[model samples]
Target: KLLSVGALTLDTILRVETLPVHQGKFIASDGLQIASGMATSAACAAHRLGAEVSLWASAGDDAVADQL
Candidate 1:
């Protein structure tokens, strides 16, 4: 078994043809959300390799936290 301790965050990935320069307004071609963080990612990788993994992280009492 593996234990990981650190921040657990929701990684928002975006695919864009061109990065916004002015930054007034921009749009992404695609986007995705995934569980991410130093320890969290490590834990997931270990789990995929057939190891039992546990992640110890904290979240706030909000919608984003609920998602985590």
Candidate 2:
């Protein structure tokens, strides 16, 4: 099975020590969300399932596109 379609996004996630309490404050970011593209996720899953997969995605820059 091969998946070849949909949008790709670079997810930016922040892990705050707690919910924002003030206008100006700082929190510790434990991790960042990334590559949460639905289709791309699926394609990667398919590949892991032992299927040849190719992802077809639309991105701003080719460099970013290549990451997909």
Candidate 3:
């Protein structure tokens, strides 16, 4: 088993053709929402490698936390 305890965050990853270099807005071709943060990601990786993993982290009592 693998146990991890630390921060858990929601990652908003974007894929774009190029990053903006000026003071202007840009749009992404694609985007992804993923469960992230050090311990959280490690636990996921361990689970993928066939380990029984557990992650201990705190989340807020809001819609965002609900998504996590």
- Separate clash counts for every candidate: 0, 0, 0
Model 2: CA > 4 A from native: 20-26, 62-68
Displacement of residue 45 (Cα, Å) in model 1 is 0.7
Candidate 2 local lDDT, 1-68, one digit each (tens)? 57569978877677887788778877666876578588878887888889999888878776655664
Q: Candidate 3's error at 5, in angstroms?
A: 0.5
Which is better, 1 or 2, measured by lDDT?
1
lDDT tens digits, residue span 1-68, model 1: 89999988989999988877775766788999998999999999999999999899997789888999
Q: What C-alpha lDDT, on a 0 to 100 scale, does residue 11 get in candidate 3?
A: 95
User: Taking the tens digit of each residue's C-alpha lDDT, what string does model 3 give over 1-68?
Assistant: 87899998999999979877887777889999998999998998899999999889998899889999
Residue 21 C-alpha lDDT in model 2? 70
What local distance difference test score does each model get?
0.89, 0.77, 0.91
State the number of backbone clashes in model 2. 0
Question: Which 10 consecutive positions of candidate 3 have the poorest summed lDDT?
Answer: 18-27
TM-score of each: 0.85, 0.65, 0.87
Clashing pairs in 3: none
